[model samples]
Target: MQKNDKIKFYSCLAPLSFLYGIGVWLRNRLFDWGILHSEQYPIPVICIGNLSVGGTGKTPHTEYIIRLLKDKYRIAVLSRGYKRKTSGFILADSESSSWEIGDEPFQMKNKFPDILVAVDTNRRRGIQNLLSLPEKDKPEVILLDDAYQHRYVTPSLSIVLSDCHRLFYNDKLMPTGYLRESISNINRTDIVVVTKCEEDMKPIDFRIIEENMKLRAHQLLFFTSIVYGKVKPVFPSKACFLNHKNIGKEDDILLISGIAAPAPFIREAEKYSNKVVPMVFPDHHMFSKSDFKKLEAVFEKMTSSGKLILVTEKDAARLKNNPLVPESWKNFLYYLPIVIQFCNGQSFDETIKKHIITFSKNNILQNKYE
Candidate 1:
């Protein structure tokens, strides 16, 4: 939605926002006062989350941390597995699909088969289950995806991500804006990362944001931007992987996504193809035969023979599993993968490594095992 459109739409619902804010405030206060206990464990627990309802780039940031420490530590990733059909704790295995363990967890499992991936609505139980694995098989470090608000298990390190384009500072409470909690709650975070930033973001812009946030001395800040990778087939056939430059300027790209933010994907696709047609859906939308038919109609309308369908990796997880999706369409469909690139990577990397290292030295689990 455009800024002015969001402002108008939210303004109409401003009254409900007051009640929503109160509920969030009370919950936070309970946690703050110890009325609601937050459990702490001996081993290091790192959490990556956001204050907004969606579109903060938490998944990529969590993946970045995993990539950083996976070699040195026996890492496990735990999530609530939003929108999954099953309940209770479930571990990702050969049988797991996007439907069984949710798209993100399934994607993570596919990407990092060596690491432990499990999901439970009750994060504390999930942690306990992970710890219960045989002594040698137990994870030394746990990466909690999107669990900052859970508060039941207190993470050793908390990193809160805020989108550079749609910052928490500029947002309001739920019904009024994207923020799930007040911006002030960011004070609880150990690190604040500004994500989806431009590659050439000005230092003055950083200074302006820092001043606006009024961050505490204990809190560290960093900036990162998205780096798109080559577009590859969703299902292997005769289709060859193609980079943006290799794709013909005359090719008409059909961009399909069911994500909170499709603007970035759309913007990136336009750079690769002269004629880009977008087919957007609500976040985490389940595809039906009707949807596929609509997509086919759009594909048929394209005049250029050099045509392709593009999707995000997360979307690919859902689409690849749908039974209604035709095999013919799957051959034409490709998904773009993305990674987070820190603006000042050296400092970010050093700080994260130092914190984890320091925790390892001081943690009781490390002492016992070592």
Candidate 2:
């Protein structure tokens, strides 16, 4: 659709968006007035989520927190497991697949097998289950993934991420826009992170973002940019080893992505190769046999000798052990991992550590007194 047509379409949905906003407002008020209760766990619970509905790099930020605290304290991650086939509080194990748990949860479980990862629709119940584990196995710090709107569980330290490309302040409610709640609701968060920032972002850019956010005095703000890692084979056992820095101008890449934000990924891929053909599916899409066949066709048709297929790490989680993937495509398929690099790295680290330390000390005092 043209720009005008798109604007008209969103305009048409404005009323519905208003209705949705009312429902969200009422629910929040109920919690605020004590008509509905928001459960608070004694152990430190850190929530990493976003006000907008789509990708704000929650997973990488959550991983960043996990890496910061995993060594010092036993860590567990709980997610709503969006689009998973299973239900209730199911803990991840070696036998778990992306089908059983969501792709993001499964990916984290694969990367950090020692850490506890579980999924459930009910965030409160998921945390309860994690806390109920045997004394030695119980988690000391529980990371709540994508739980900003899950008002039932009050986190000890809530971090809300916003995409640099689409700040919540510039967005409306669902249908008309991508936000799950009012921009005013941002005050509920302890920290706000602007994700997917340019590596060389100017000081002026940060100032503009901070001014637009109008954050509360109690809230902290930080900016981060994506740092793409070396390309690794999705099927490492089946594919021959290739040097990570092998991609060059001569290569043609077939970039397959099932993510909310593909522009950044595509732009990064374009930097490596002259020709990049992207095949984008919906976020959290479960690739079927037809999707694999289409991918096989796209990769096979590329005439360049240095042609290969590339995907995001999240997509790789869903495709890794799938039976539908053509055998010929395995050798050429690779996934790029990403982690966030904070603008004020040391400050962000210190702030997270301080929250955890304070929580631990208070918990100890309470237990001793009891």
- TM-score for all models, in order of appearance: 0.95, 0.97
lDDT of 2 by residue, 98-186 (tens): 88999999999999999999999899999988989999999999999999999899999999999998999999899799999999999
Which segments of candidate 1 are over 4 A away from where they belong? Answer: 1-9, 365-370
lDDT of 1: 0.88
**Residue 163 lDDT (model 2):** 95
Question: Candidate 1 — which pairs collide?
Answer: none
lDDT of each: 0.88, 0.91
Per-residue error at 77 for model 2, in Å? 0.3
Runs in model 2 with CA error above 4 Å?
none
Q: What is the C-alpha RMSD of each candidate to the true structure, in Å?
A: 2.4, 1.2
